[model samples]
Target: MAQHEDMQEIKKRRDAVLSALVDGVPYHRFLGIGFDRRGDELTGVLNFEQKLIGNPFLPAIHGGVTAAFLEVTSIITLSWNYLWQDMEAGAIDLGALEAGTLPRLPKTIDFTVDYLRSGRPRDAYARAEVIRSGRRYASVRVEAWQDHRDKLFAQATGHFLMPPPVTEAKAGKPG
Candidate 1:
């Protein structure tokens, strides 16, 4: 079916984007922020090793680091969805474009994070849900949890502003 083929194509595109983003990210390496996609959803894992633990008394993952992870994961997942849809609709050849030409470097317009539970010194998991996607913006909700923990470590909602297309000059001389 055409729909099935389209799905496969989207997955390929998503993987390509993920590879580009994660290839040289030192912080992502520290946190294990790489993800696996299932249909429209993305699942990411984070580990709290000795490096991530800040205070011995609390044994808590730093709030700033957790927020950074949530923000990065949400933006990446939303960008992939946008790219996949654009490619499937014949609007763009995302893979053919130079990495710099990728549109929609989402800037967080606003974000609210709620700390439901303190993160333990262990692996953590996060799942992002795309609440709404529009031509110029998106809304996402992300939930993070420590391994084997009943309560969530944090929950965040973000409003992201999609960047406009890069001008031809900035895209560099045509090859």
Candidate 2:
């Protein structure tokens, strides 16, 4: 039936988006960032590791590491949430990427982070909310927490430059 086929298609698309995220991005892998999806919500997790520790006295996760984690979480969430617009025909080209050729990454126009408390050495989790998404830019609000969602250690707002739309990518044209 058409409904069954639609479900299959949705599952395939979901896999593609997650594949491109965990495999395609280098920094994501380095950070041990993984996702836990509950319906439409995704919690990005940075698994605690000893190397990530910054302050020897308090033994906390590095501020920079936490910042990068939050940024990547926002980017991944946005990319997945807008896959139809972000990818080619809603299909992620893993083959083209294997050849070291791929679409562009959205550049950061602005990023502001607020460190509310020491990021204790433990698993870190982040969630991003897209405030506004436009053709040229997107604004995301992100928060990172350890232990509990309400107990936040850092929060950030980011504006990223979106890549050109599919209409701009033409045959025989370098994008």
Candidate 3:
């Protein structure tokens, strides 16, 4: 059925995005971020390690690392969402995204991170949501958790400059 084919295509796109994200970004791999397909959304996980600890005394993960993880997760989520729009509009070649051409990708406009608790040395996970997406800009919210979603280690919200399929953003139309 057409619905099944569409779902398959979406899964393929997500896989491509995940590949390009985890493999393409060395830092992300260094952070040990893992991707999970939870029904529809992507979940990011970072297993705890000593090197990630900024305060060995507390054996806590670095605040900077947590911030970086949130930022990277948000960016990847936004990029993946944009992939569908770009492919649908035929605005850019799929290979551009697949090739890991991050040089031309969206840049952070503003980022605000809130450290809810000290990140202990353990496995860390993150969830990102695109709060809003315009043609040229997007706003995202991210949360980093160790054990459970309700117990968050950090939360971040930011805006990014989207590149492709942004023709109408500058003209003030919805993306």
Task: Please name the candidate that would achieve the greatest TM-score relative to the true structure.
Answer: 2
The runs of at least 3 residues in candidate 1 whose Cα sits more than 4 Å from the true structure, single-residue gaps closed, are 1-13, 24-27, 88-104, 148-150, 165-175
Q: Give candidate 2's error at residue 125 in angstroms.
A: 0.8
| Candidate 3 structure quality by residue, lDDT tens digits, 51-116 | 899998987999899998898889877876776555454564458668776424678999999998
- C-alpha lDDT values of all predictions: 0.73, 0.80, 0.79
Local accuracy of candidate 1 as per-residue lDDT tens digits, 63-113: 877887788778877776766655555566455443534454678998888
The CA-based lDDT of model 1 is what? Answer: 0.73
TM, every model: 0.74, 0.83, 0.79
**Candidate 2 — what's its lDDT?**
0.80
* Candidate 2 residue pairs in clash (backbone atoms < 3 Å): none
The clash count for each model shown is: 0, 0, 0
lDDT of 2 by residue, 10-49 (tens): 6666665566666677777777888886645788999988
lDDT score, candidate 3: 0.79
